[model samples]
Target: MPLLTNREIAETLERYANLASITGENAFRSRAFQRAADVVRDLHEPVIALMDRGDLRRLPGIGSGIADAIETLVRTGALPPLDALQRTVPATLLDLLQVPGVGVKTATRVYRELGVVDLPGLLAAAESGRIRALPGLGPKTEANILAAMEALRRRTGRFLLGTALPLARRIVADLQGTLPAGSSVAISGSVRRMEETVADIDLVVSTRVHEAIPATVAHLPLLSGIVRHENGSLRVTTHAGIPVDIVVVDPSVFGTALIRATGSADHLALLPEVLPSAPTEEEVYSRLDMEWIAPDLRLGLGEVMQAKAGTLPTLLSVGDVRGEFHAHTLWSDGTATILDMVRSAAERGYAFLGVSDHSRALGVANGLDAARLAAQRQEIEKAQRATGLRVFASCEVEVHRDGLLDFDDHILEALDLVIASTHSGLRQPRDVLTERLLRVIANPHVDIIAHPSGRLVERREGGDFDWNRVFAAAAATRTALEINASPERLDLNHDLARRALEAGCLLTINCDAHSTVGFDALEYGVAVARKAGADPDRIVNCWPIERIEAWLQTRQT
Candidate 1:
């Protein structure tokens, strides 16, 4: 696509920064442009407007070169130098630099020596041992490069919550060891809100630990490789192949830093309206004066107004969750047995655990038929009686390709909880998908809608349900929306969760765990819900045991 306007200029500059970072070019020049682009993106007034007013030069980090570039973009709608560079360096060559280990020198060498540009060409060269033949490139290095590239592809141009969460946890743990006494640390941003895919991982540490950040970050077991370390921030790649960035700041500024880093960018842009004159992030939240709002709740949809008016819905936190709602067992694609699942929940101090094995429609998952489901329920009841843990017999009943529940009403009525979900036919027209979902919501036996959107982060496309209709139906039917916590499927993403709440729909954060290991995945779902601005009161699982039982009973009636 042809680059046009200030936005395009900003994007082109970003490209320049990425290329510069990869190629080992003049680092300061690249950083200057990147920072300038960030400033432009964050500007409330249009870049063109700032240029027309001759005020572009006044913005920090926007030097004479960037000022001239902005003016050219505003006037001629193009950057001649950037265009000329694109011609000199094949666009394909630039793409090669996107590979994790590919440097500018390597990219230049590949283009000059092997005439290889782009991923496919590079892959072929690596396979043919041509990449290993390059000076300073060994066979093992070439293999590692190829492996990294493949991992990158699977990552789908985004960070997976599954990988990022553990690394963040480790970093937080390490910070505890290095920080001054009474220091606090947390993982914030989309990871905190439980989005399945993350662009970056953000950590906020409150410490006199600022001075020790470098050593703490340097020693992290996850830091198999360090990409860059500047100031108090460090970016590293974990042994598990996920990239993470850690920022260390003082305790007083922790809230502001958390808010700043835990941003959707779009959400942060709307903040000035909430606090017209507050320049710093701390001031932005302090204007309304509540222990700064959590990053996941910064969705910009009037959270600030609610905070100002003292009507902000109390968002759900990790502690509010009382049970595992959408879990599986050996009966249907889960690694644990019903008894094992119940025992694990009890060990975690949960008041209840919902055993929601897959229903028969998900044949590939070895879902349970009525006979098996009945047996599983009996087993769960036996386990509950023996272990003293309340085990709710639930089923993740699939909404078939034809949009009907996997189990008939008779079977659904027998369950303690039924979480209806769509496992196929995601590409149906919006209206059809909406109607299909409405039917499931209206089914008196279905108590919750699991992973309503059916997105698998960057791997699978999301469904086409008309959210307005879906949320309305959920509200009317009193069906809770499940925030599936699996890293690959943090479906019912933050925005949808917010809309669900606005429409008076209840939300539940579920691990959708297939194994005991998967039970920890609730963090991701909670992160998405937090980002959606969900409060503890709106999340049914956060309720006390009696309250949860009452709610479930109400759904049954």
Candidate 2:
């Protein structure tokens, strides 16, 4: 059986859960699968290893049934329950669920009552005013469906960076063993550049035996089938349906070939037509009298010019990050307890960790009320004393639609860190959204604005804000804007991060972790900062604990 990553397994389980819901299966059963999917997705270890140890059900939400289903999926690459449902439910209904507002209930309603089976049919019905006339749905719901479908259409063919990167790394790791001693292998193209979404995976391999490369990859368990094989390149499909492109080149011109393959078409246009052969990318850049550009910054957006001018900013790296501030614990929806979370941070050699659970307004996340928040502080104090890690008390306070914060001013002042974020009403008009964020930024006690855009990659669009006004307000207040490192929501993405830096705003790169393994996403956040040409000095969380504490103290006063 081909190896399945945790994400792939989680996605399979989630699909089964969604299918069950659409088919009117038992609600508790479907939720069990869904919750199990969430647990598996956040896990740092491979699910197969746990299964090998007969401990798959040891996970929080996994029961005997879900464990069996996972084992069946890992072994056979199919879920019997999901297959059964596909026979009864129109598979197109699954596509309908992909729309933002169309949940299982809504999807079932439309398919059974309105006879709407897919996006096109739904769009047609909405345009014809048939959907609003349904028993429960209104004109507002129809408009929302139309808008969501339009947004969904724009996101086709792209896979999240979170999904594509790990798979590429896995493939590259497997292929690395096949290479001769001195040969090289690496991920390239957009995946290397750490783009938010990717159309396909690209790899560069340097070897003496080009033909053997294809023979080796052909046997990779991850590959479903080889799409095409040529003299210098090969294409294959994974079981999860992502495309892979591999380029093999002679060792002599490996660097040249890699630079060519790792291009943004526009970035390549700026280079000399005929490139010199070199053994390393650094040498290639040296021959061209330019600095070796980090892959994330090779977007052809003045980077080449900056390279020539010797003016490229020193970019932040994963190692430069000292700690994470926007993390959750058992006080909220997170699985890990405060002690476990602090221990994980300490194990990572972090000088400090912040326990920023969700505030009262986000009840779905088990957001902490003032009393709960105060109680959690006792736990934080206990964890800090036990772990010898400086644990900061904090809250990811909600920014209401009307511009009020979830916590009162006095409550906010008592915390070591306060992160204000918008958890709902992201679709408000441009002025309203901008004003809402601006108000939060201007608040005296709010230290940082987390996930400024409130977007999930390929899932939903973010708020339409007057960024100029927002950035200006944040800069004026010395408020930090977060580069939320969750692969699903790399909010304040590279482009916006650059603009915020240009506007003199302080930035923070946080994992916004919900579990211990969640801290692994810090690399993605650092990549965002690097892509924005941000220096380590500009990121608040990159500071030493003493400096960070001083800054927090300043904010409080």
lDDT per prediction?
0.75, 0.87
Candidate 1 residue lDDT tens string, 444-477: 8999888889877765557767888888889998
Candidate 1 minimal-lDDT segment of 10 residues: 272-281
TM-score, cand. 2 vs. native = 0.85
Off by over 4 Å in 1: 1-156, 175-196, 203-216, 229-233, 246-290, 305-311, 535-537, 544-557
Candidate 1 structure, TM-score to reference: 0.63
Q: In candidate 1, residue 478 scores what lDDT?
A: 87
**Top-lDDT candidate index:** 2
lDDT of 1 at 531: 71
Q: Taking the candidates one at a time, how many backbone clashes does each contain?
A: 13, 0
Q: Which prediction has the highest TM-score against the true structure?
A: 2
| lDDT for 235 (candidate 1) | 80
Question: Model 2: per-residue lDDT, tens digit, 466-505?
Answer: 9999998988888999999999999999989989999999
